[model samples]
Target: MNWKKSLRAAGLVTALTFSLVGCNTEGSYSPQEIIDHALQETKEPLTYYGEYTMDMGEAGGKAQVKEWSKDGKRRIETISENGEHNIAVNNGSQIIMYDVVKNTVHKIDISKDGLDDFPSQRDQLEILFNTVKDTHDVKIAGEEKIAGRDTYKIVAKAKKNDTLIGDIEVWVDKKTWVTLKTITNSAGNKMTTEYTKLDDSAKIDDAQFTIDIPKDAKVEEISVPESESVKLDTVKEQLGEFLMVPEENGLTLDGISLDKGIEDRSEYTFNYSKNGQQNISVTVFKANSNANKVEPVFGEKEMDIRGQKGSVMDENKFRSISWQENGYQYSIFIGNSELTIEDLVTYAKQMTIVK
Candidate 1:
């Protein structure tokens, strides 16, 4: 055999072997397929432990270490900030928040019925994920290298003419198909979530979702709305015309009632929900078409609540402006006068009127 001929044959064999290996190991996935796979991987309830820096608008910056666990039925979160650890354990319908600093614990029943909390947590997650999955058009935008890791970028938009969730984008890992980042926009406000140094290796304990209140700490259980005295029938009849319900369950209209109507006066009331949190208010009107700015009988105090900066009024006339802060403008103006801006906030938090 000629040595040169033999060398050429060996080279040919090597090239053929290389080609076979490439074919065997090459990944076959379209961008959309990759995104779908990634989203599926993230569907399972996960527990994550991480450090975060939050930019709270105007309240300044906050640095906290947090642990969050989601099982199909419940969620458990613990946040450490300012040398204090606050633990919140929620099972969809019930929330137990323990404030280490105050050494007090508050429990809120989110459950409509007395059921295990875990299922409630899981159900909420399912609803949120499904909203992102079904209501929007999801697509793989492209591939990019972020922080040295190859990732698939997926963008989402509300199906045509859908005004709710406007747009969203997600980044998925090429190797694991795990979502590395997500961005959501409703109207124009945007929310971005990025996962860094994620470890799927940790085994989450089921007990984390349950909290045992400390014996020495004070335990306070408060109903979300505290139930107001109002005629549900009258509120439905009066305010039903002005109220528009949200398609999303995250926000709801509730507790439409009328307080005692003053002589020659009409009082109306209503309420709304945001992310399972309730706010309500009532309006006592003199039955007069009024000015935009009404004088407060009492003084107004400055305060911030639910991410809104506003004034609080203490007065004889109780008029309310209840608003929902769900990345949109929602407000109800009820009354003929005597309530100040502060009274508006009271209405925002107290009246439960929805048709």
Candidate 2:
């Protein structure tokens, strides 16, 4: 056997192996495949523990946070700038919050709280990738290490019709496909979020979702009044020609509800929203019996709407205009928008009775 020749051959094999491994790590993935992998949610919910820091840029201050999620349940702890601790524990059906600074425990039932299911971070990524995968140009910027794991740097840029949300860059874990960090630069403001520590395999139990309260702490239970989603026809049948929908066709009617309170008066809420960002709630009051009458709030502006006097009030960037007409009390509530009292009055005057 030729010893020198054998050593050279072994070195050549080792170099080839290293080259192939390097190629598989960086150059083997396409941007679309990376997006697809990021979009895929694991069927089995993973047990993980992580600590993260959020920099809100100039819009808000910074915060330190810790999170533990397992088996469709999670516990989150946040520390504010003033050294106050806020902790929230969600066990899928109920939520328990224990304020360390105030020593209070607040319990809320999921069904009775009137809170909608918010999309998770993964879900939001799925939505963005799905919506902009074809419209926006995406590329693999490079690879980097994040939170002690190898990640693929994916960058997607919005092309046209932009606003506060501009271009985005994300670093996703190579193995778990979880987003480890994200950077966004929009409208001259930059926001960044990254997991400073992450552990995908953690020993988490069911007891981790419950919090301990102090002996002298105050406890409060919050529950909303029962409300049902009723159809538009059902509302029109009860009260003929109800004025709920706005004249704006771009905003669609997304939520409709009837709150059966005290069995004598019914409260109807019609929610109109555009892109889930802006909303207008048209709340109509109807009396099942003839004993209830809607009264105008005192000290509000008196405006005319279809020959009826309406009370208008604007406080804390929320505007409400209420008027009694056709045996019903109609109130339009709008918040955080550019619409004014006069604009609402015109809409109210233009409201056609649905027959």
Which prediction has the highest lDDT against the true structure?
Answer: 2
Best by TM-score: 2
lDDT of 2 by residue, 1-355 (tens): 1112222232122111000001123446898877766666566765788887766566445678888888768898988676879889888777888999999988888855434433455556665566455546789999999878898898988665332235678887787776777776543356677788878778887888988878998999967456789998888888877765654756778878987544436778887777666567787876344554433322245777778877776532446787788777788878436778776776677677786
TM-score of 1: 0.43
lDDT of 2 at 126: 64
**Model 1 agreement with the true structure over 1-59: per-residue lDDT tens digits:** 01122222321221110000001124656645554454352334444433223222222
Clashes of each: 26, 0
The TM-score of predicted model 2 comes to 0.58
Clashes in model 2: which pairs? none
Q: What is the lDDT of candidate 1?
A: 0.45
